[model samples]
Target: MTERSKEQEQGGQVRELLATRADEVSLPDGWADRVLRDGKRAVGRRRLAATTAAVAAVAAVGVLLSGLPGTGEQPPASRPEWATADSVPQALRKMPVGPDTDVPYGTRGEQGKGALRVMLGGRAIPIPKEYTGLRIWRAGDRGFVYLADGPGDVSVVVHVDADGTSTELERTAKGEHTTQLNVSEDGRFAAWTVHPYEGRSQVVKRADLTTGKVGSRSYDDIDSVHGFAGDDVLINWDARVQNIGSLDRDGTPWPSADRDGGVEDYSVASDTVLLSTSDGCMRAYSIAQPDNQRWKVCDMEDVHFSPDGQRFVALREGGYVVSDTSSGEVTGGLWSVPSVHPQDMAWEDDDTVLLELAEAKPARTKDGMIAPIAPQYGPSYLVRCHVEQERCELVDTGGPVKAFPSSSS
Candidate 1:
């Protein structure tokens, strides 16, 4: 067993928190994004036509966000002035704080995550006392994080890189209104979960901030949809747990997983989907083979397939353990905390992770700042985490413990 100290990527915490699980995941573009959420606006920032809880896959927002044509055809949604694409600290932009109207939810605990802010272009974007959609920019010697009532509402994105170097990108939606926003790493794309109806849907859409070209996806298959496998494949039950249908990279429903059983959590690395069975078993499959070599099984809890699938990490009863996919070897058994069956897990970067300690709550809080006031299973969870090496950090972004916050913070 390896020392239970190293944190795995598949076990990281999200950037922000949402009110519902639907706000947590999103699909790819075109067919993939469409089938996932069923054409519904996302729960993050941007233009939303209606604010409805129609989380029925991409067929949610404004009707069906998916099933539409992925011709990149339509003119981009009309972005508002306040919704400019100027740069802001990518970190703060991903926080759970929003609108500045509602109060935070979930278990109240002492925050541990240091103020993780974003550096737009080059400068740090300051979070507004009220998050009313802002733009972030980094000029020569100055950095600005500005918010507007709407786009075009501001002429420039604060300041150009002083001497004409402007890495400012404004984000705006033309079709509906948005509640959440997400900017890609290269800064070439921006996806938003819009709002219009007073409803919630398991839907989401992404757009090239500059082109305004949009795409969508979803995960409303609660009973059917199992989890995400790798980059583009979404694992869903066929007959048995491992008898999974594999959605291609393009999100077009493809083949199926070779193995079968009560698939718990499935992770995709390379060409295989590492699946964990309910009976404490595990196996790997090749998207191409779907049913060839069904190998490996281990007794573990909270099994997570690594990003590359070369291996998997499971938080077993007493400690953590890592397994080699090829030979099903217990490379190492990490540390142990307590008996906690994590509800959700994400890889922060690769090594470290952000845990919610969710199971702990409905259980306990650090300083006990929060006492079950109206304890009724009404979001009374404390988001604290032990990031592998150090102490337990608090996830107090005011976002959904499950949601990665609004991709657009």
Candidate 2:
């Protein structure tokens, strides 16, 4: 099968790790200035990359942020500063490291009843009972943007900070089906697709987590929502024609990558876009200077850029490879069970990856072909793989894995 079709087939099994899926939308005015302000407010540099997580076909809600909206074209006065946008290197260098925290994790069922049963740093974070079946994405060091199913047809969007203070950012409007929440790498903005029951058009809504302002644009046809680039939202529209564009915050649209190319993933740190060529090749391009190509790969499939934008992980040659983003050279490898099928892959941190895989044991059949001993395994597992060490440790073994270590099993 073709690479694109293979990735799509795998995408079904890889639901939990589909956070790297791309969609695009709009950002507000003074995006660069806002990014600069956030950078200045940063205290110390942290290497961890904040990324959004998404589940297949699930909808989330948009909500209120803490700050006041900016007046005129100037940056908002009340928005919290998080990172820089002056330069890619400086942005990565200046990213603030907040309180000690690990990526939130829990077994599959924990998202159902007893929501917020997720463990951070080995402690159970208490979540409100109303916020059931929570799907969380890392925001700031001590913060997260989450979507939870509320009473009735309601789904609420919320932000939780380092102090464990929960802020309701948004809740779904009546008769609205909100797509999964996608957060910027710096945790300053959240974007999602909204299908209102009253209309046939799709609306992409973006919430400024700092200014508490939400921006939206309507389109007759939207294929998918990519994540973010700096503050610009990436989107793919006109599926049949494959039109792609980077949407600005103030309703202005930025130059997009090749129209015929499909966006594979994005890196906010470098403002880079990884795209798939119409003919099935992959390349990385700069969103600011569309002509400035960073790297290209003709054979890679299911590419995921690291949180820092310096590296990426992809399934290549039937194995997982970590390659440098600048040169597209394989730098390291990840452990995987050939007998097991991976459903999804999420970056636990800059140097680590979390993979959801079908738990299976390899067996040799009469034909000497290696296959799973059984037709099915009980439940999938989240395996933590270290990039540099080339090793993997099981995180979900049908129970909590001890405080969910920050760097170790």
TM-score against truth, every candidate: 0.37, 0.59
**Reference-based lDDT, residue 11, model 2:** 45
RMSD of each: 22.2, 20.1
User: In candidate 2, what are the lDDT values of residues 67-95, reduced to their tens digit?
Assistant: 22111112233221321222112322232
**Model 2: how far residue 208 lies from native, Å:** 3.1
Off by over 4 Å in 1: 1-212, 217-259, 262-264, 278-280, 305-308, 339-409
Q: Residue-wise lDDT of candidate 1 within 1-409, one digit each (tens)?
A: 3322222211121111111222433322333322222222221222222222222322222222233321111212322222222221222222221121111112112232333233333233333223334433111123221222344322212222223233433334443344333233223444333333344424444433344345565534222333332323243433333222222124534344334456566555456656666667766666666666567767665655443455556665544555676766666543333432233343333333333232232434588666665222222122222222221222324332212211111
lDDT of 1 at 75: 16
Name the runs in model 2 displaced over 4 angstroms: 1-101, 108-116, 126-133, 197-201, 211-213, 217-220, 239-254, 261-269, 317-319, 360-377, 395-409
Candidate 1 Cα lDDT to native: 0.35
lDDT for position 157 in model 1: 21
Worst 10 residues of 1 by lDDT: 10-19
Query: Which candidate leads the pack in lDDT?
Result: 2
